[model samples]
Target chain A: DAGVTQSPTHLIKTRGQQVTLRCSPKSGHDTVSWYQQALGQGPQFIFQYYEEEERQRGNFPDRFSGHQFPNYSSELNVNALLLGDSALYLCASSWGAGTNTEAFFGQGTRLTVV
Target chain B: GENVGLHLPTLSVQEGDNSIINCAYSNSASDYFIWYKQESGKGPQFIIDIRSNMDKRQGQRVTVLLNKTVKHLSLQIAATQPGDSAVYFCAENPNNQAGTALIFGKGTTLSVSS
Candidate 1:
């Protein structure tokens, strides 16, 4: 079975521009979460989606938003990107929205804000 | 405020030597903890996890120890190899509820020299 997959492995965006990253969760998984990782740092949570609804969000601003499709795929949108927004966007998938469940991560989409 | 931090930023060990990485978390309500390893140009990969109820959990060659009393967590790698060179992060679910986002540490870089 294929694992979690993310689109546009690498991307470049200018300041004040918008960018959209896509993610296809692992087979048989339902929950999707997004994270941002700067160079040489661990990932910081962005938000999580379950059952086509956003269930949890991190400290990110309104500029960061996400959507989950019925097929468990997800999309992360960042509006008005800034230089600090340049980082690796990681998508994680879990079997269920349950405590102690394992979340598998995708290779991530590298976004460069110019 | 919730935060997870590592005791060390970098660790170098000779091949076949065991390695230990430590992390401290600020959220007392966190119940689930996970360890992830990420290589250059890649996303975090789950190594092992332990819940607050359990003090220790062993996997193939890795062990995760969780001390809820002190809000501390640790990962032990047996007979480390060159392939094990990567950045290690400890993540915790701040809230015990399902669908909550995970708080990750800055990460500890492990370099296993052959």
Candidate 2:
């Protein structure tokens, strides 16, 4: 089975520009979450989408937003990107919400903001 | 084939030796913990997980130990091999949050020398 898949493996955007990243969850997974990994740091949770609605969000600013399609594919959009926004964006998929489920991740999209 | 730890605290281990990676979580409410292995340019991959109810769990050659009293978690690798060299991360889920979202730790790079 195909695990999680993300598009635009690598991206370069100028300051104040907007960029969109996409992700397709693994087959049978209905929940998708986004994370950002800075250089030499751990992955930080951004938000999670379930049932086509954002169920939980981290401490990120409003510039970051996401959408989930009926087909289980998701998109992450960052507006007015800042140089600090340059990092690896990771997409993870899980089943239902609970303490028993585990998430599967994709290769991630590398975003570079200049 | 993955090298997620391009720049981080590294642990060098001799081939066939046992390895231990440590993590200390700050959230006392976190009940579920997981360990992930990430290679260069790839998303984190699940290794093992343990809940607050259990202090220890074993899977194949890997084991997870949780000390709820201390809010510490660890991953032990038996007979470490070259393929086991990767950045290891510890993630925690706050009680009811389940697997919806996870908080990750700054990752430790494992280097296996033959």
Candidate 3:
């Protein structure tokens, strides 16, 4: 079974621009979560999607949004990106919504906002 | 707000030695804890996990110990190797809700030397 996969391994955008990142969940998994990891920092929760609906969100602003497809794939969109947005965007997939579930993560998309 | 934190930012050990990474979480209600290893420019990979009900869990060459009384958690890697040199993060599931995101510690950079 394939693990989580993310697209556009790396991206560069200027301030105020919008960017989109994509993720495909692992086989047999139904939940997708997104996180942002700044250099030297741990991954921060951004949001989670299940059943094509956003279930939870972190402290991020409204400019950070996400979508879940019927196939359990996910997309993260950031509008008016700021230099603070430059980080490694990670996508994790889990089998269920419970806290006890194990999660598998993708390689992540590196976003560099100039 | 309950914050998860690490005791150390970096650790170095000989290849044949055991390494321990420590984390402290402020939330007493956290039900699940996870350890993740992230190689350079890569997303975190799940190392091991322990639930609140359990005090310890073991996986292949790794072990996770949880001290609920102090909200302390630890990951022990036996016989550290160069491949184990990476950033290690501990995350806690504050709530089992679908939207509730896992809070992660700052992370400890583990360097295994020959």
Candidate 4:
């Protein structure tokens, strides 16, 4: 089965620009989560969408938001981006939103803020 | 393959040797732990996972050990090969978070030399 997929393998945007990244969950999966990975760090949780609603969020600010479609595809939107917002955006999908569920990840969208 | 981190904690191991990557999680209530391998340019791939109820779990060429006593988790790769060179990360699912997001550790880079 096709695994999780993300759009725009790489993106470049200037400060204050708004960018949108898209993700398709793995076949048969329902829950989608977004993560931000800096150059030397592990992926940090951004937020998670389940049943088309944002169920949980990390310490990120209002500038970072997301939407999940009925088909299980999701979008991560960053408004008024800053240089610090540059990172690899990873999308992970799982069969359910539960502690025991394992997640499958997408290749990720590399966002470069100039 | 994935892009290499700007600076990684590298583990240089000889072929056929065993390599271990360790991670310490902050949430004591984390119920699931996972190990992911990310090659240069690609997304993180699931290696193995272990649940809180179990102290250890084994996969084809990898084993995951969870030490709840110390909130520590580790990934052990057997008979390390050059193809096994990649960054390994451990992720934990904190308890009762509606998002079911994973908190990741700073990754450990593994370099297998033949």
Candidate 5:
């Protein structure tokens, strides 16, 4: 009954550093997606992974990347992090690719770029 | 986490009152819509969702109404509680292989005072 799980609940990094955040999707879920939420705004989609391949991506730059393992776990990597990249990073998992599948989210990793 | 702004339009309602949070989606082709409630330091939680073919979907104490013609979506909470206070977001997706990304709108902060 475990929901999605993410690692490093909070992180502190400096400008130009790199960070990798991990996520384990819920049991029986096959798709994982990542999002970034800035203060006072809704989450902006980062990308989605399915079948161990990235299937969809948002408007973020190439410096932001992700990977999905065979077990449906995911990792979000941000290179040369900027202060603007500092935000709450969220991982969500859903069961199917079809419509009406509900997505469950984990407690996000808060990245603070100093 | 809830988005905060000195000027963020907030709906302050008594604990026992019903609450309605509204969102206007931009994509007319969006086939799936979801409502998520995000509390401080946590990721967005799925509250409810509706597909384009349906006008309404109801959960335990929540309901989602979608008006495709108007490109509007709403979440209705019955007898809102302090635990219900959070930033509510509306996310839309076309539900297709080519457009599986969920685009989110800026959320509205809902405050319920007991």
Candidate 6:
């Protein structure tokens, strides 16, 4: 089956503008998580969604929000973006909220804020 | 501010040689750890994972060693190849909770040359 898939492989947004990125989870997976990876750095968790609700969140500000649809697909929305928000946004999906379940990731969307 | 961190930022190895990447995590309660390899323009791919109860775990061409005493985690790659060159990240599930997000290290770039 096809693994997680993210849309708009790359995006360009201006400072103070908003942007939305999309993701489709793998088959039979129900949980989706978002992460931000800056250049030369590992990914930082943003939030996690299960059952169409956010179950857990990271240290990011409220400016970064997300939504998970009934189909288990997800979207990440950033409002009033700043240049510092420019980074690679990754989407990962898992079968459940189990502590030991493996996560499958998609090719991330590269956001460039000018 | 407990987090995962890597010892080295970069590693260079020759083809056919074995390579090891090291990481140190500050969360003593973490029960799960994972290693991921990310190539340019792609998302992080799972390599291997180890549980706190197990000292080591082996995959096809990769191995993960966990030293709970020193809070150390390591990834070993057998017969390094040019295609294996990528930024390797060590991640941990903080607090051993079911829905907790993973915290990742700053990653170590692996470079293999013939």
| Selected candidate, larger TM-score, 2 vs 6 | 6
Comparison by TM-score, 1 against 2, better one: 1
- Residue-level lDDT of model 5, residues A1-114, one tens digit each, is 899999999999999999999999999999998999888777888888888888788889999999988888999999999999989999989876454488888999999999
Clash counts per candidate, in order, are 0, 4, 1, 8, 0, 0
For candidate 5, the per-residue lDDT at A106 reads: 94
Candidate 3, residue A39: CA error in Å? 0.7
Model 6 compared with the native: what TM-score? 0.97
**Interface RMSD of candidate number 6:** 1.4
Interface RMSD of 1: 1.4
lDDT per residue (tens digit) for residues B23-94 in model 4: 777677778878899998888999998889999889998998988897778788999999999988888777
lDDT tens per residue, model 6, B1-114: 539999999999999999999999998989989999999889999888888889999999899999999999999999999999999999999764548578999999999999
**Model 3 chain B weakest lDDT span, ten residues long:** B94-103
Better of 5 and 6 by lDDT: 6
Interface RMSD of each: 1.4, 1.9, 1.6, 1.3, 1.8, 1.4
Q: How far off is model 3, as Cα RMSD? A: 1.2
Give the Cα error of residue A4 in candidate 2, in Å: 0.4
* Cα-based lDDT for every prediction: 0.92, 0.87, 0.92, 0.88, 0.84, 0.92
Candidate 1 lDDT over A1-114, as tens digits, reads 999999999999999999999999999999999999988778889999999999888899999999999999999999999999999999999977765589999999999999
Q: What's the distance in Å from true for residue A104, model 3?
A: 1.0
Model 3: iRMSD? 1.6
- Per-model TM-score versus the true fold: 0.97, 0.93, 0.97, 0.94, 0.93, 0.97
Off by over 4 Å in 3: none
lDDT of 5 by residue, B52-80 (tens): 99999999999999888977888889999
Q: Chain B in candidate 6 has what TM-score?
A: 0.95
Model 3 lDDT per residue over A2-83, tens place: 8999999999999999999999999999999999999988889999998888888889999999999999999999999999
B1-106 in candidate 2: lDDT tens per residue? 1112222368999999999998887778877788999988788999988888899999989999988787778889999999999999988887645346888878
